[model samples]
Target chain A: MMVSNDDAALVVERIGPQALVEDSGRFGVRHLGVTQGGALDWVSLGWANWLLGNAPGTAGVEIAIGGFALKAEASMTLAIAGGDLGATLDGAPLPPNGAFAIERGQTLAFAQPVAGLRAYLALPGGVVAAPFMGSVATVAREQLGGLDGRGSALAGGDRLLAAGTCAAPREMPMAPALPREDVALELVTGAQIGHFEGASLFATFNSPWQVDTRADRMGVRLTGPELRCQLGGMISEGIPLGAVQVPPDGQPIILLNDRQTIGGYPRLGALSPLACAALAQCAPGTTLTLSPITPHQARRRYLATLAQWR
Target chain B: MSDAQIRVSEAPVIRLETVGMDALMVRLFDAIDEAHMPWILAADRALREGFGEDLVDLVPSYTTLLVNYDVERLDQREASACIRDALIGLRPASTAAGREHRIPVWYDESVGPELPRIAERLGVSCEEIIRRHSERDYCAFALGFTPGYAFMGMIEEALATPRLKTPRQKVAAGSVGIAERQTAIYSMRSPGGWNLLGRTAVKLFDRERDDISLFRPGDRIRFEPITRDVFIEQGGDTTPLEERG
Candidate 1:
């Protein structure tokens, strides 16, 4: 059940739902105007690495929706975290948020999620992949960051190889998975918050919004009451991640990791990082509410969350 | 960072807000203007210099600079304070004017697909439309939509045209088009709705070239017209400019 030092390849047995090699994200190249293409749910990506005693930003696999299956060519220790997409190894159900050992020639498979949309798979060390703009996060649209450094998603017959040596098998206590359904995302109103009509503002915070089918790494479209703004014909400006932009159609689109650098649409505000993580796992038709909070409160909550993970 | 040399100006329009746990947006004045561009550039340069590696990235737009940092190492208050101080010390003298590039374009019917429609809308002959468009110098206002895509501003008032009602699913690379007050060259083949008037044989974006993008914000551009045969002879397949430098 051991892989020889010269044997570096891990063969694929089955390709379930969706699996793509990912890392912290591409950075330092935005000055060249490249988007920071990375995992849609970075918090979960970090947690998955932490579970395996690897650097939080190490490259791993991001399995969306979950029906991915893989066979190990060599014995290895792996950790699965983020999203409770039912995962199993060789017909035995495996729990999320902990590390396990897989022997050579064994198969690992994931089924449709019972909760959450993205799941992370981390090897003992990290996934071996070439860096594109200083990251291995796969961004298919930009044609950057992937296993081959071409930003292609995982297709059938794709092979994954782990980098570095495997650590001794260890058992780490698992944390309770958060409630993904009926989650309330927190918002910190932007400078343009005052421009929105009072009624629209009220509806924004009070009304329930449904995630529209038009969702991607770039942004998520929300179907809810039209948000009217007082300002018309405003100049286009640099939009931030999580900025809830209200275009001419009045529907709100929350920009995400792969959003364009700038936008002209008026924005109600930006959702906090934690809120974005929660929203990232939500499927189309899932309802969400926006709760406004002060910047101070948002910062405190974000710091607290990070501290817990650390 | 020392405060002695820092000069401060009140940017009433620029709003400072937390974007995420780790990012903040230092928005310039609400609207885009020639005066604001210098300030935005200076502030961005100053902050990068002041923070060094602490700053994750600085994204500059026509009127805003989004600064991303590491939350584990820096917080909103510390980052905001540093940025505000840097903004106050920002001097217009430090902002370097972006390089100017001249692009040759063929404005004839074969190259300029929308020439006739633009001429009819402006009540001018097709020749006059091309003459006016080629004569006026354009400033690169920003770059976005796709890699190497430069958004130039203040097209000739007469030649100013609206975008097409239905955007073309695939615009050829090096296609020069106009939309309202902005003129742009499509760096790569992609969907676009602008009014196409010409194509350039010169590569606007070549990944392999040391200068991947021919134009940057603040660069001046002029279009030169040439015949169709010469364009094909130049080995222009509109393939993406490979990264060389």
Candidate 2:
């Protein structure tokens, strides 16, 4: 459905770096070579939607590294969660992790990050955009999804709309912990994990790895130990989200939502979904340690986390 | 052989590997094989129906299928059971499974910068390289790297070329290229490392189409050589792509 200007809630004044519309993600289409594009920090996105009482996977604006400003087109209520990107209402600081009321012509601006790398802003209903392949999540590289239905990032002059009017506002007492200097990520060991040398395996979990600047929605390159794999190049196979692929150079890249469908490099294992959410919040140069967990343990933890939402 | 006899033959042993908490890597074969396509497609179809609402996404590649499931609905054990049951008594689909496509290509030095280099490396003329590449009907093994980008493969060994040492910063849409034994069309312009040989006007991926992607996993594909004029007439871009520093 087309969102007419009558219901337009906000208008983009400026965009710094990048911002995009995201939801749970695009699925059931991997065979078409389409990557699952969505909010990198999914936990926060859920909380943002929760604050507004929308479905957990409802669409929201993922503002990355701040410097985005929007002018309220109409009086409305919205929720902000995830990173503390120093959001403000007409120059007054608006705290993250709760719903707030804004008047017409009031400005909601996001400055440089004060905590995490990305913040999710959810509307009362949800950001209304034409869903491409069943999602409005933008994968810029693939040119799919977003306001224009071509994966374009939020830019000046773009109009934003919410599907429905607001209900009673809600708030969360706390938000997910912001990334720290030494964040420990939970990883589930599998797929070619035994092929790595004992020493490399030990280093993978025991040492500190720094997030490299080559980070994006696709994947994050962790620099630290030169992990050596005993196995040679194998046939290119399907890669799952969070698969830690170690290339010939030894730097391990943790593939994420927007990663390619297949890869040939050897992999140590994959990070748990929660771990991926945490890692997405870490700024480049943040130190990280890998904590091994079993698939059963990971599943239990995933269920427990989801249970908290309801 | 009869259908019953084919089913009686030893089925390839498949293994399942845990991918994080919610997904499993269903490994069909340890190596790449042309025969693996039918089995992969069959498994993909079965799992899509079997998992129903529980399945999040299933990614099929050359030798493995990564099944992403909803952990809220099924645990690891239950998901595995569903997978095994769906794959029970699995048989490869017949040779004639998916749609066949005839893609017309315009092969020229102006559009394919790597054409002369590839011919020189193979010690053959450009026309010979094009002839060898167009002669075989390739199987669409997978779709990836980008939307509508189908990785069709096993080009003539004589025509096979290694990927560029350094990927071109920009590869125009419809640029046909080969990397090792694999050949694919650049469905959308992006940075690519493949060796370009020609260009196609066909839109492999069109959002307006009922099926956004032109090629499915098991589709058969053949390349028909076309004149530059025909390529231009068919809406193919002939503007030379320069190698950016």
Candidate 3:
């Protein structure tokens, strides 16, 4: 692939509910109250980049729930990974988890979700957007990152550029299986976990929790047993990604990439990184369960997953 | 580092807790206090310098500093050991190290929609409320909610008010508001429930600026009352706030 200074690789013909450019995340500046904005299903993002022979943290477009369409301005090979959003290339069904070449004037459109909630589209190089605070991840709430560097979502008639040229598309041998059954999210319990009543702890692990409609990039609310914590009026502290905070109402909200930097609610624990990625693909009303795992086990699992990249 | 060099007369009791797979929380105290700033700042500095390329981010809040690290580069045991090594006998930074800022604000019923309501609730004049709010200096306890939004606090007990039951859909940039003892300026337009007292012309956050944010955690802030004309002269928005129909 080669680049021309004034040429756009693709043009946004139509955008559905939401589409944002995301990279690894913004970092080293949370003290300034900046949220780490990035792809929710980062594992998929890594695979998307890997298929295109780009670095794991390269920026890509995160298409949520479908209805997004793009026109190729130039002939190029692009990779699609993650959730099985009903995708079509030039009016034909386009399978995911592989790289495909599109000719100029061909239309690439996503109809609806066939399996998961989001799909990752990787440009030959990466989605080229002006970086804000060392990241191109769009955090709309904070008005940071995106095409204009103002956190604007991908809209109609937007021109997208590639950061650089790619070598050649590589064949993807194996992809992780999509979770179809009741998803089990592994939680690394700590931080106010002891304050929860014994029965609540049992229910937290034993019960089936449904994904509530009020879920987004900020956090996901789980409808389950009313978890009561004995602690009263805790001082607000820094919140990490995947922190499952139990508010006064007892419902747990798992904080995600764009969550507030600090919060006061009691926390049962945080979901492991892989668990968070798996949960990100879950649609509303998806049944899930929590399983407690030691920090050591969580780290070991994460390392094993990372080993797949090489 | 030698133990004698880092030892302090009264070191804060600390806890290093793992947060998920890639982060650790360094909890300094169970409660919030202005005195905790010195220690928090010290640990933040030590951790950043210690972790170097491995540190992802360090979020320093009221009572804890969250250290998000590169999981592939450093394991939990190695990260915990590094944190302990950097903080084992760490001395708290000087309280005087923080910068002091005097922010000018225009207090009135127009921009501050809740001013009249709060005055009536306390059975005091709007002028009296302004005076009470500006009489003392507040400490910047933490920065959250949005970029450059400093949560400052310990307002006069009499002036401490609860948040609104229903949050406003759009809180104008530079809107200064209070919820309980904490007061903050809305760095950008955001949905909020804080009882607004006034607005400021000072830019809380500016990406064009070298520092980006005007206030850092542990800084001191004092509000100074300004006339409407002064507020306008300083580039403050004077459009009266209105309820969404």
List, residue by residue over A193-258, the lDDT tens digit for candidate 2. 999999999999999999999999999999998999998887877777789999999999999989
Q: DockQ (Cα-based) per candidate?
A: 0.41, 0.77, 0.72
Candidates in order have lDDT scores of: 0.74, 0.87, 0.87
Instruction: Give TM per candidate.
Output: 0.89, 0.96, 0.95
* Winner by lDDT: 3
TM-score of 1: 0.89
Residue pairs with backbone atoms closer than 3 Å in model 3 (clashes)? none
Q: Which stretches of model 1 miss by more than 4 angstroms?
A: A1-6, A13-17, A169-172, A308-310, B1-20, B93-96, B108-112, B123-127, B201-214, B238-245
Which is the leading candidate under DockQ? 2
Model 1 agreement with the true structure over B14-62: per-residue lDDT tens digits? 5786655567778766655555555666676787887788888777777
Model 1 lDDT, residue B82, Cα: 78
- CA lDDT for candidate 3: 0.87
Candidate 2 lDDT, B138-232, residue by residue in tens = 88888888888888877877776778889998999999999988999999999999988889999989988987899988787889999999999
Candidate 3 or 2, higher DockQ: 2
lDDT of 3 by residue, B60-156 (tens): 8888888888888998899998888888778888756567799999997777888888899999999999999998777788999999999998788
Instruction: Give fnat, all candidates.
Output: 0.43, 0.87, 0.83
For model 2 chain A, the run of ten residues with the poorest summed lDDT: A1-10
RMSD, every candidate, angstroms: 5.4, 2.6, 3.6
> How does chain B score by TM in each prediction?
0.83, 0.93, 0.92
Rank list by DockQ: 2, 3, 1
